[model samples]
Target chain A: MNTIEVKELRRIYKTNIGVIRRKVKEIVAVDGITFDVNRGELFGLLGPNGAGKTTMIKMLTTLLIPTGGTAKILGYDVVDQANEIRSRIGFIFGGERGLYWRLSGIDNLRYFASLYHVDPEVTMKRIPQLLELVGLSDRGEEKVEGYSRGMKQRLHIARTLLHDPEILFLDEPTMGLDPVGGREIRQVIRDLQSEKKTILLTTHYMFEADALCERVAVIDQGRIVALDTPEALKQVVSDLSVIEIEVFGVPEEILNQIRNLPFVDTVSVEDLDQKQALHVHSAKGSEAIPPLLSALEGVRVGKVTVREPTLEDAYVRLVGGKV
Target chain B: MKPGMMKAYVHVIKLTFIFTLKQSMTDAFILFGIFVQPLLIAIMALFILGDQGDGLVIFIVVGSGLTGLWDSVLFQSGNSITRERWTGTLEALVGMPTPLAVIVFGKNLAFVTQSLSSMIVAYAFASIIFGYPLSIEAPTLFIISVVMTVLSLVCLGLVLATLFVLNPDVQRWQNGLEFPVFILAGFLFPIAILPQWTTPLSYILAPYWAAVALHMSSGGKPDILEISVPWAMMALLGVLYLFLAFWLFRKMLFKARVDATLSGQ
Candidate 1:
């Protein structure tokens, strides 16, 4: 059975104001929707702003109740079995409201440790492992208030994993991190997934999603528009393939000649000082590169490379618009 | 309780108690002197009002103490939540799986314990130095304190906590509320001595009746039977507030389904 199963869930909030200045109105936040995540699978919910990804995660996590329909986590109902579900899963918010700055890192962990009811003996051992995993062993005794934003985020993941929960709900886990930190966090996620824990990760960064999630659900306008493996989703938008070509000091004639290649769908050039940033798209990366190169052969080419379709390009195509 | 359930609730209760105690110092200190300001006025009443001044100390104690409890729950719970929300910490806590009820209990319990302890200290100080014909009958103080805690402040905390969930802007409400609760709740002087216009406003709420009952029990006025009517109203309102708090929490949870922080799209 799927670790999480949701069926036609809905959440409607009332915003009342009218003749009485309090007449009720409904704001349907999560319209009817359905999906299931398998055990040990790192599922992803991809969405643009306000596409109901967070709403769905909150509902499944038992922080919110659905107005219509139902969801179950580890075979426990999110509504009727809320307490049970809360125990079975852990959630990490990419929110500023992450930790108790007043307390040290291990103190924060200990507090949550007590809440999880891990035996004191077991928790003692687990705390060190968690601190080690997050590379915070040295800082474990320091108050989180002094920690930088990235350091605090790592602590948040530790808290989410504290209960040794089988399923993890990570909402924009690598948000606001620098490239190195993001990579570090991505590696941590891979490690968690390797332990066979199910993670339903949400992120707007396509590369972040593509790198971590094996299967992804693309949500837009409060509904799931597309759900597939990252490669599968890319394949959906891979039809109009876009490739970037780098060239130096190419004249307009050669640029025009490259654009006129048989299979080269569209070509654009940019003059960056003495260099040109060339953009090309075709049905296949290999099919378009040779002809484009041949056209620019005599143009004092310094460096030439064929680019593959990035998930960013796929995302733009997925939304059918620009970022 | 199961081991896990026991752990969740124990953490809730223990954490709540500490939080309330720490928060109470800042809140009650501002008001403790306010709670006693009337007692000093009552000593002045010995010269101003003569024989009638005999029970004035109890009057101020019971009245201000009653209103103090009101102030503690309303101001602390509402204002703290609002302050934290603006500071951007409320969303972080609320995003967790732990119920909102847990957050309310932990924070308010801390404030309440601090208020109770500080109020006791303020009363002891006044009884020693100012010496306003004090009497601390154990059974009476015990019964009234219990009533004040359960039927008035804690119940009110439920409502205030719910308000925190939605609107954290409580300064206006707290400012407008304190004196009215003092005047109407009959905390300082008798609601009866207040002008007829003010009596209607003061006795209209549960805190007013509760203050009066506490005043009577604390040796300020008539017997317990005379205070029974307001005591009954206080108890009823307490239950009602608790029910309303639960309902409010349910709606907040439903409304806050999308953890605002996770707008990944």
Candidate 2:
């Protein structure tokens, strides 16, 4: 069964400005968007600022009522059955925003545990396990205000899972972490996915989407532009193999001559050192590379590299370079 | 409701209480010195008003008691909403499985706790330190006190939590509930002390009547049965505010847009 189902979601905001408050602005933060998150699958929403990623997540989480359409989590309607939905979900937000600064990290976790109504006995068992899982077992007694950003976020990871929720809403869990810290959080997420938790992760990093999400949705202006596996999106632009070539002393006119070759659809000459590169674009580009290499036989083919198109490249071309 | 919903209120109460205590402790030292201000004011009212000494003392006790409770409860309930809005804790709560009612009820736990504490202090001071010459009919005073605190705090939390959600900066203005309540709530003097022209504003808020009911129960010449109308009025306002607050906060939650601002942790 789908763990989360969002259909034709929309949201609008009315703002009044000016000293007289006469100025009115209506902001459509989330436009009609639809998608489903299957059980135990990692889902990703990718977007720039103001692209309505948070708005969409809020609607699914039932934090905001949809202006249009409907949604469900674990088969509970987001609007009509929000209380049931809340019981089944665990949520973590990035940075210093989620945990209480004054409370000890353990206390914060315990407080939320009470909110979740874990039996006191189960809570005792779970607290230490979560503490160890987040690797804060020893420091659990310390207050959150004194902890570093990464440590605080680790505590948040523990807090979200304390209720043993079936679904997780992780909003930018590794947002400002260093490379090592980000790597650690990624490992934790990998572990959670292994445990068969349905995860909805919103991230700006293409690699994070690629590494964590089984399938990704690129949302812009409150709508989903594309949804596919990272490899599949990369395939959107993989019809043409991208090859970088370096050469020595090839003239622009000669590169133009190479461009006129029967198999070549487009070409440009550029110098890599003293060598010139015949930058070539062709339909059966892989098949045409041998001919292009033959045509530039006199030119030293100093180095050639071919690469599979990346999701970011697909993001730029198909998802629009703006978003 | 599931057992989880029942316990959710307990958790909210714990958080609400702890936060209020933290806030009170941070301000307690300073208020500790001013604590004697009520004692002195009670004495002054007795001395100046002479024949009205008992009446005036009841006003003082009721006013200080209710205002003290109001001061803390308003911030407890309203400020929790505001602080959650500002710190994004409310956003986190929004994402949780906790219902809006549980959130509000739990948040009000702080104020309810504070109201109980402040009432104790106010009554203890009135009965012991000031010795302001009053005899409260215990049962009547107790019943009325409970009604006033329960109804007012619930209403204020419900109606004003939304204001905080709408304006995160309004947290600073929460004193708006406290200061006016202290001066005009008619806790030290009878509402009749105010000119007839001012009576409308004072009565629109229920705590004033609560104070009067306490004064009647403890110090006034009125019979116990005569104070029934006053106690009933206060209770009615409290219930109305409670229902209104509950409905308002629910609507606010539904209308909120709590979106994540970043991509990763």
Candidate 3:
């Protein structure tokens, strides 16, 4: 059964410009997107900045009303049955700012516990258990201002669980964390999954989605371009092989020439200090490499390697190389 | 509602109050508003109107305290919701099962209660440091008036918080709103001294009645019937402010959701 259902959700922001003569510009942030998250499923939304990933999460979480279409969390309408939905769901927007810096970790939890209307007796028992779960049992007395970003994030997770919500909406929960911190959060998410909790996470990190999510949706320009298992989504580029050619001074026109080849799919350049690396994708595999080299002519070349496409390559193709 | 839900709401209010009071304690701006500014105003009032009579000391103390109360309401209570937005917690609060107005009401309760300290501080500074003997003519009535003042001011604060969230231009004039309330509320003098036209303006403000009731009980003992007028006005206006706030809160939340500017600067 679907725990969260969204159908053609849309959000448009009207911005007024200028002082005297004003002009209204309507920016469609989320444009009629439809998706569903099943019970106990780990769903991920992958997109670049301003691709409506956060907007979609906000709509499902009832933080923002949809401009069109409809969404239901645990079978309650997001617009009309918000209070019923809010009670059963918890969400965390990625950042350090959501916590009260002046309060201790325990105090913060205690305070939010009251906001969620947990029995004070239950809070007395649950606070410690949550602290232990987040590995902050020893540091619960410290003010959030002194806690590291990772600690604050863990506390945020603890905050969300105070109500023991059935559905969790995390918007880039690991956005700014270090690799270790991010891994710890991913572990927390994994633990939640083990407990059979439903989670919808949005992130710009492709591999993180591949590692954590059961199914991932790749959104671009306010719409979902592809939705499938990470491995299945990678099949968009599975037929093509990626050739990385390290060249010292290859011009843009030469890269364009490789794009014009019969088998070449897309060509993108990555700056590598003194040298620029050209990533050329083609369906002909290694057979297209010789022509790619011939197009390079007198451009000083470095090591060239060819490999199968990963999710990142698939993401690149779906978003049309916007990454 | 059921008794269980009512108890839960009370518990939520209790927790929110304690936490908000603790948080405000660490803020230097809140400290100045509820403490330093009031004491400074009290000292000026003492020196300026000092020598008039012994009764005037108590008058100055109550008057200066009202300034602190109004300042707290204007700045601290007014920005309660905006402060949550700035800290990025507005979304979390809005998404909670409990209504946003309930949480804000708890916050305003803390602000107004803590601001009451301005009166105590001013009273202490007068009776202890300045060696002026100050005592309320009717302590019971004064205490009751103080309670009414807090409730009414909290309701008024609710309106301000939601109004400021709904209209950013009104918040831009927040600094300008301060002394006008002080003048019109007659925190330092009688509103009767002002033009007759401004009396209706003063009558509409809860702070004005708060001043009337506070001054009468503290400085001179008035009969129950005489003092009940300000109390009734405060009660009536408190209900009006609450109704206005209820409407404003709905409009503000809807607007914020539509605009998706809950956490925006």
Cα RMSD for candidates in order: 6.6, 7.6, 2.0
lDDT of 1: 0.68
Instruction: Return the top candidate by TM-score.
Output: 3
Question: B225, model 1: CA deviation in Å?
Answer: 8.3
Looking at model 1, residue A288 earns an lDDT score of 69
Better of 1 and 3 by DockQ: 3
Q: Name the regions of candidate 1 deviating beyond 4 angstroms.
A: A7-34, A64-70, A77-81, A110-125, A220-226, A233-280, A283-305, B1-10, B20-67, B79-99, B117-151, B163-174, B195-206, B209-240, B251-265
CAPRI band for model 2: acceptable
True contacts kept of each: 0.21, 0.48, 0.84
lDDT of each: 0.68, 0.70, 0.92
In candidate 1 chain A, where is summed lDDT lowest over 10 consecutive residues? A314-323
Give every collision pair in model 3: none
Better of 1 and 3 by TM-score: 3
RMSD in angstroms, candidate 1?
Answer: 6.6
Q: Candidate 1 lDDT, tens digit per residue, A87-106?
A: 67888877545566767788
TM-score of each: 0.74, 0.76, 0.95
Q: Ranking under TM-score, best-scoring first?
A: 3, 2, 1
